[model samples]
Target: MDYAGLDYRNIRFPVDRPLTESERAARYKQESYSNASPMDFLSVIKLNSNSIDLVDRWYPIKGFNTWFGICVVLVSMGALAGIYSALFFSNRTAPIETVDWIGVSALTPLFLLLTLGGWWLIRTECGRFTHYPMRLSRKTRQVHFFRQNGTVLTVPWDSLFLTLGESKSPLSGTTYDLRAHVLDDDDETVRDSFSLGYPSPLGNAESIDKFWAFLQPYMEAEDGVEKTWHHLKENTGYLVPVDNRREGWRWSIARSFMLGAHWPYLQLLFSPFLGLNALGRMLAMSTSKIPQWPADVERESQPEVNDPYVLTWRDNGSLGWWELYWPLICTVVGVGAFVGVIAWVVSGLWR
Candidate 1:
């Protein structure tokens, strides 16, 4: 497929295009404050027939990184200090109360656990932050990690293991992590590692998977290992092309929910509320074609026009007001309810 016109793939970093004042400002804002979108982080740079570059320029926004670690440390410290002051310094004349001891006893272990966990997280983030612009070169079959001190560590492709790491949260379902680890001489000890930072729960599995699909073609593996890996990759549903126009918002929601449900069945219970948000997104897309791929690539990847299921919304004609308005109302209500529940839970926690 010809990707000559693709905004991401075609552009070189330190992008050559001249920027207007506003564009420059926007660029600076993105660099300083905003996280790089999945597209920007994983966008494949085809250097030549044998070489491709996958660079990691941003940290995963949603994880136990430096910011989260700092919050944990600050909160735990304040709570512990408050407890200590109330117990030891509030009234010097009063005998040490049993209740005070109980409070201290109860909170001490939890506080220690949180503090230690947060410290570990801080160290991990420090390592990641000090290493930026991690470059993986397919041609050299080597992954190059660029450190802050003008040093680079290169590990061959065979010395690395690519695996998916996942974590589950009550509020956000399950999040997937794409990580690469470098093995030591024993081939068992992990010498170094880094996450590629897609964080799939935020409707980004498709994008992450697409990036993985691109890498799989270049990755070298033994015959048996390659076959097993390919089978697993195909089952991941990342290779499936989503036709948003034909599938509509409903289909998108169903697909996302199914992905969630595949790992955790609890997500199935919330499908109704989730479907509402999905419907709203689909309604917005109804007004225009939501192209998931570049023109040439889309043309090449999509099935033949004669396929029975390829009819788009345009081909099927517009929905009547009766068909759209009811769903819109339900979606608004679902969003409101979801927000209210969150606010109530947060308020209770604050109190």
Candidate 2:
């Protein structure tokens, strides 16, 4: 994996190739079983004579409509306004009755809470999706974080640490979050951190290891004593998680759908907002079947061999036919349902 000459930023580097009998035997001897699959690495890695740059970006998943977020906000606000108008400002000709007053009083607080909650959710989504990407530079030995508002924070390479955080859900099993943190001058003070939260399925430790392996080589090359090596050794793994029974695109999509369905049942009443989020994720995962691996990972201990199966960006297209179908269906259904709801509400108001 000599990534020195490869332009990882614009290219889709192939992380797997057909192994020869000798190679397979060698790998089997090294590890009895292989847990890692042929995965794709979407991030960009640029190498220079004196430095390397890695950029992990948040890309809109294929089959997931980004515009759905806008639709969700608009429909929610519209519904809120409609409800308020219906409850609080009904026709003057129809004298305000005791029951009407009671209804208004009861529903007003609920409406207000829903309005505030919707706004907060919209803001959170915008922050998560539209924020700047994470950039790491080896030349300067610094990691630069760009905020949504164009602000940048730079942290020294030596100060950086990888933290693994876990969350358990009774319905969806356990999910892990990989976070990058920077410690302050005293090394005891924590300055800043960011996370690529729950990037893969449960038990897929290889994804986390691959992400860390990208930074490990550069970090180790730095001129001072490394404090994070122990952390690295602890987190890194040789075996990938495997299940032969559940394989291929169909199984992957089913697993993703089940995971996405983990939203609390109580939240179903707020389907307009929560449903869109889940639907977007489901579509994205279903359409993108290939797993992604980190590019330019240093394998210093392995023998050098030219790989003939390497793939370039030009060889790949944006989305395949099957991948495009589900997203199109989701878009049509989402739009149709949205329009029908609006029409029904407007008709009820007229009545």
Candidate 3:
């Protein structure tokens, strides 16, 4: 799925017709599925009785993967150069041997794989907008999509042609994302399209349906949001870990390590790579622009002064600063210990 949604490189489905039920199950009955809760993802910006804003295609893992790609490309090139130097520059009668040629040939495919894979990751992630927010207003019954060009596309909530964005690749396999198609007049031509939320695992239609089910009530319910909803109740009100808010250094570092398992030992094992991943995210976010809503959309989206369903990062919740920053603390201690070990080794050598 094109989370940024600006680039139209390929059009797999026919644009002139509505997506068939068989094509993507567009008419799939919307319902909540296990692990389909909004809290599982970190794309929401704000949620209130009046409206909700979400970061389009905001996947936290992408930042780490982008830096990983750079490392792959660099390491592959360095290995290739080292092999070439040792084979040709060694003081010998023959500059290169048959054994060296065989070694080089054996390593060629692995080198290409690393170089190409890394380049693909960097190409997809770098030089993109920090985020594009989409606002769904219950009061106005409109969906506002923020574009990279500082323009907002406003369309009625019910008018959008919704479908699943499914793509296959040899490297990453199959992935899915929720897509909303903007139809031209006469409702036959898909003029443009954009994705919502983050991508999901292959064939996880249940997740897609459940996510849509969550949005349906938010946009259509006559009453306020369900009190039982975790995001509406258990949320920490800390703005999402996106660049939209000015997060502190500790929070930024902590958020990156909050991936996958929660065990302390596992966290310690992965801290070094996680630290580099966090730096990559910070760099990417710094280079991109923060999206700003238009005056008209802003005015329309304002919540009631006494809005009871309003939720923001500022609202105090169960989590505290210590819990949020523990990952960064552990990472720092680990690095210090590593440095100490190196210093002790150097001292022994000098003695």
Candidate 4:
């Protein structure tokens, strides 16, 4: 049941309802699944109100509090400390301009940039529950897209691809990862075919197989000639070297250096830097559930749009908000801390 309350604050979604069935059918017959149905694009909000307790995010199976709770505390503490320092101390090197104060001033731009950008992005997540939809359909291998706790998509049969075979997992006997890709191109160059998460029954190979059978029809030859697909090798849990630079050797060098140069920036893009993890997480999570069905994906097709059901929902948690407030928060903290340094410096300079 849906909670009645709705929250409009910090919501962002742009939807153009699919044209009426008759209209869509006349426009594009092959792609149209239902003459009566149209693509219903919407953003749902949940809040605690007299009507109902509002919508909270959902994580399949089980999960806990978002980073917002912890982040707020950390931010508050940091802000408080900076305030204390700014009001009390001074710097030794620069008596006239306290180093602490100047340093805090330096962080202002970064925070402002992050906050405004983040607030703008919140609505695009486009769902009611915080947790992603975690499930597998017994009848159809279609991927379930949930928004406001309702199924928004029945992954087009042609969009899903499954690799069915014997693959042993560390714990589960044998498993198949229900792989799917969107039929369309992705927004970024890095991922032409984005991955949706794994189904609920990720642990058991049998369940994975059931998922495979349903998604199997969507499996088309990724290309006319054989090449390495991103989701291969993992199906058997065996390491087979592929001819691609995205993973393995070249990727390591790029990832290593990029991380070293900008780790702090990268750290903020995910949920709490990987805070809460679950047991059998792969089985429970969607990304973990689908193993890339190994196809001969040519390196030339580095960014290939092989399928259409690519799950590309992104949740940066409160980082966007955090980033927004970061500059302000950091400024407040820095200013507070800087003031302390200035005080110490001025006192000494005068003395």
Window of ten residues with lowest summed lDDT in model 1: 1-10
- Ranking of models by lDDT: 3, 1, 2, 4
TM-score of every candidate relative to the true structure:
0.37, 0.50, 0.69, 0.28
Q: Which candidate has the top score in TM-score?
A: 3
Clashes (backbone N, CA, C under 3 Å), per candidate, total 0, 3, 2, 48
Better of 1 and 4 by TM-score: 1
**TM-score, model 3 to reference:** 0.69
Error (Å) of candidate 3 at residue 117 is 6.9
Q: Compared with the true structure, what per-residue lDDT tens digits does model 2 show for residues 1-351?
A: 011111123232121232234322222111122243322233332323233333332332211233354454565566667766776576667766888778767766766666665554334323332223444554455566554334556666555555553445453366444555555555444455554323443334455554444444444444211322222223321111111111233322322233233343423333343335445444443333232222332221112245222122223344433333343444345556766887898799678
Identify the runs in model 1 with alpha carbons over 4 angstroms from their true place: 1-58, 62-64, 91-94, 105-113, 145-173, 177-209, 213-351
Error of 1 at 23 (Å): 44
Candidate 4: regions farther than 4 A off: 1-65, 80-85, 88-98, 107-127, 130-144, 147-151, 163-177, 184-351
For residue 110, give model 4's deviation from the true position in Å.
5.5
Candidate 2 Cα RMSD (Å): 14.8
The lDDT, on a scale of 0 to 1, for candidate 1 is 0.43
Residue range 134-189, candidate 4, lDDT tens digits:
22232232334433323244454434332222234343344333323233333111
Question: What are the C-alpha RMSDs, in order, of all predicted structures?
Answer: 17.0, 14.8, 6.0, 20.0
How well is each residue in 1-351 modelled by candidate 1, as lDDT tens digits? 011111122221122233234322221110122232213222222222233333232222212244446557866886788788767777668888788788799998899789887776455434322123344444455666543333456677666655543445565576554555555565555555555434344534444454454345444432322432343334332211222323345333443344344333344345345444354334333433322322432233343444332222233224333233444444455556766875787578546
| lDDT: worst 10-residue window of model 2 | 237-246
- Total clashes, candidate 2? 3
